[model samples]
Target chain A: MSRRLAEAFAPGSVAAQVAAADWRAATRVAGELLVASGRTTPAYTEDIIQMLEELGPYQVIAPGIALLHARPSEAVLTTGLSLAVLEKPVEFGSKANDPVRLVFGLAAQHHDSHIEVLAETANKLSSPRFVNSLLTIHSESDFQRLLSDS
Target chain B: MKILAVCGAGVGTSVLLKMNAEKALRTLDLEAEVVAMNLANALEVQDAQVILTTPDLVAKLEGTRSEVIAIEGIFDLNEIGEKLEKALG
Candidate 1:
């Protein structure tokens, strides 16, 4: 069976309406939350940045959404998810999916781990209505509600 | 038939794409051994018939024998299905 988003979500890892000047800063915000939640080390953030700089921003999976991650390493404490919603959208240099506002930082212990949560996330984010609700959420509780939605 | 799902790190989005590709293949009434691997490893794969990845990753796959297809939306099953259909046809 597929896992729910909440199953892999890190506790207190949600940051709402973060003021980020650029996509890097927005990714940093998400990474920090992941670090604070004990899901990953600070090095994971730099790894993600390096991956983007070296390979490109293919992590911008859809319109206004970006999923930040790197290869599974010692930096990742476990498989967990963190979220950061920007106060204003920023570009990740992807021509097709640009002006990203929602950033999800994922730290997986293995290559195949967390597939269920990732699928759940993909299913939800693929819907425009769910994306809009996540973008417009006013509080962390509201965000939780949206994330926990089946 | 074989399909390769690729990304910068084989661990993240490639797995997402791999999952969707399997679903797309089922929707298209097809079958293939879909594998997700990092760019470095993917460069060494000589058996796959198709490689699914984002557009930016396409330029790096020049010497590979597989037909590279760039998918814009990793989560969009319909897009994946359509692209796989066209590629298979």
Candidate 2:
């Protein structure tokens, strides 16, 4: 059951790139990637941007972790997940855990159905070993292996 | 008992918090219905005895009659349960 959810990270399919200084730029890049992957539409892409604008810099759980989300309205064409590793960590008001280097953006349509997936992702990301692995990962295959073994 | 868990999307962390809070309440033998919703949906969800959310959203919930419990660490189950118990009591 755990592996079923973990397998969502496609080894070679995971696209990674160094983001510019701005967080919004990074979100747009991820949104574009999702659209390119056929996970969402152009309209949905704009919705993701609006969501970040309205609810963003979600530093409430800050200090290295930010959970970026939006309403399940016109923005989400389908349930999707994507990751962005900032070249330089950015601050989102997480004083206790400032400077977040990794961002895992989640989009979903249902309320409670995706809870298990988010919980699993949070548990995996919260681990020191897992995060360290992500930092060192150079290829999509490496990333997928990390999820597989996690 | 009904509890409203609010966050940015009402889809991600808030839902997780709701799950953890529900588990905690169940451990205490408290019967409750946890409804996860966004801050925009807060006005629609009436009859909730307590509100669980981050400090930012809680601030916007000012002047409302609902008992508000501002949870700093949404992932910390202990803090969430403690705040929930105090607010709902």
Name the top DockQ candidate. 1
Per-residue lDDT of candidate 1, residues B6-89 (tens digit) = 999887789889999999999889989999999999999998999999999999888999999999888888999999999986
Model 1 clashing residue pairs (backbone):
none
Give me the runs in candidate 1 sitting further than 4 Å from their true place. A1-4
Q: How many Å off is the CA of A14 in candidate 1?
A: 0.6
lDDT of model 1, residue A103: 95
User: Can you write out model 1's per-residue Cα lDDT over A25-102, one digit (the tens) per residue?
Assistant: 988998998998899999999999999998888999888888999889999998899989899999999898898999
Deviation (Å) of A63 in candidate 2? 3.1
Q: Chain A TM-scores, all candidates? A: 0.94, 0.80
- lDDT, residue A1, model 1: 21
Each candidate's interface RMSD (Å, one decimal) is 1.1, 2.3
